[model samples]
Target: MAPPVSESPPVETLDLWLLEAAMELPTPLHMLVEPNPHIALNMADDPRLSREELCERLSLLAERGLIRVHALPDGLQELFSPEEISSAIDARQSRTPFGYSLTDAGGAIWEHHARPDWSRFVNAGQEPSADEAQDAWVIEAASLEAADAEFHFHESLGDVHQPVGESKHGEVLTPWQVTYWKTLPHGYRLRYVTVPRPADPARSRSVPSRPPWYTRVWL
Candidate 1:
């Protein structure tokens, strides 16, 4: 018989941060526990976790099958439980590499906990209809705030064409920031959108915006 599923631990601020980091890239245990230049630069203000504490939490996630610990390069050939992987690292066994990646369950949990309202936003790939495309949309780009513009769909243009809009602050939106977007209703006004920061998971900051716009859109 399969082993019973372990109870999921309380999702702490740091745990969500770790899960997000692993999601972006399969992370080795050391990268999380030790002070690395990348982590130092990106996660400067985040709390520092000891190896033991990190391992314990990771073990819980593994036992619950929320995350998978496996051999690196290609994790399919060999898999390791959190404890087993931790022991290998402690022993300084370099022959085999280990890293963490979220399982389906982990991804679900992370989405549920981290981006509770993400479903409202439409993905960038899902282009608006010809009629809808004619209207301006509020786009959540890489930078903090959303941009109001009309996305293109020309044959030469790829998934998203060059967007043209009235200049407010002369801010430019990069291709990557054009990830998610939503339409603004006719009489609404644009207000601050709250987004969670990975560095400081506990607190949420507003997506900076200018004074009241013509229509309000929830991001």
Candidate 2:
């Protein structure tokens, strides 16, 4: 049997940020399908909502303040039992989960965190790419020397990297990291690796370009 799902940590901000500007969605179906159980659903997993329909509904949601736009990293976003969510909310390097209510604020953020640009949430605090990361290198994998003299690789998840991949045992690699290891000059020690990134598009010093006539600058 699969292990239980873990919950997400709570976010503190609660402004009425529009879903559309956050992450694109079609409709605003804020009603919880399973309130007592408080299960989260994503039609993206369902086949009934055609691509067009899905887009329509997601778009609608985005247009309203019912949701927030956030992007999921390569390895994140899964159901967590109330207990797991509870735990995360209880402890964090930063904020904590308020409660199970999915406060109008939390729900609103969760739904639209994907709006303006679905990548926002997923990329939060994401290290600048290697080049951008400067020395920013999200750990792709880590390992401990095995008893049998084999290298044990532990993929990073929110460790050296945010939303880093889960470990071989399928647990978050939050604080645990690869401390010591042996590798050949050409042979990598871990199963995976992350290279530096180019740069942050948001801060790139690109040359200014003329805006279309429709856009005007006060200056």
Candidate 3:
């Protein structure tokens, strides 16, 4: 008979897991309070944490200096004290949701505890390959369009004789051809075709011809 597979160990409590999620960026209170399918799949039990409980947890986290609460969406620059934040939540005065972000201490704890492994967690409901997870470069940008435009402007350049956006391997791509992308802690991990050199070797007569085959770069 085949040996039974052992179950994986739990990483941390649901509250701490939420802390790690906030470490990525400032998240709205509604997103945290809502039922996350990803978190539910990993945990043994999925409890619909009440607003009171959620606020209490946030207050506790804030008191410990692990997180900061803001009024949102304009109050990101202004942080609220634990007592004040809790009161605001309890009062339900604001029409907009509150935002939560990790403090320096919280970031430190996340770095110490979280692994850089992508296979362990799902990104956009799909697991990335080990190579992609390890080799991908993190890009910080306000939006995907901005990041894509910047990448093309910096990486794609050549003389009139040679076409732009053509990889060394002769694979031609447009400026906005971002094949794959995933969210990261600070920004995004994007995979796209890269042209290391001019597509036409003859344009640069002195340089030797490289091998023909396009390779994807994880940015």
Better of 1 and 3 by TM-score: 1
Candidate 3 has a TM-score of 0.41
Q: Which residue pairs overlap in candidate 1's backbone?
A: 141-177, 142-177, 188-215, 188-216, 189-215, 189-216
Put down candidate 1 lDDT per residue, 113-215, tens digits, no spaces: 5553432332232223445434333433333332222122111133223333331222333333211111122111121212222342122233232232111
Number of the top-ranking candidate, with lDDT as the measure: 1
Predicted structure 1, TM vs. truth: 0.45
lDDT of 3 by residue, 1-219 (tens): 112222233224555566555644566665554466235233223446666666666776676666678766546544445456545554335676577776666655554455334322212112243553222222224345544544444343342222133321212122221212223333333343321344544544644432312211111
Clashes of 1: 6
Best by TM-score: 1
**In candidate 1, what residue range of length 10 has the lowest lDDT sum?**
179-188
What are the lDDT figures for the candidates, one per model?
0.46, 0.27, 0.45
Each prediction's TM-score against the native?
0.45, 0.20, 0.41
Residue range 70-101, candidate 2, lDDT tens digits:
22211133223333333333332333212112
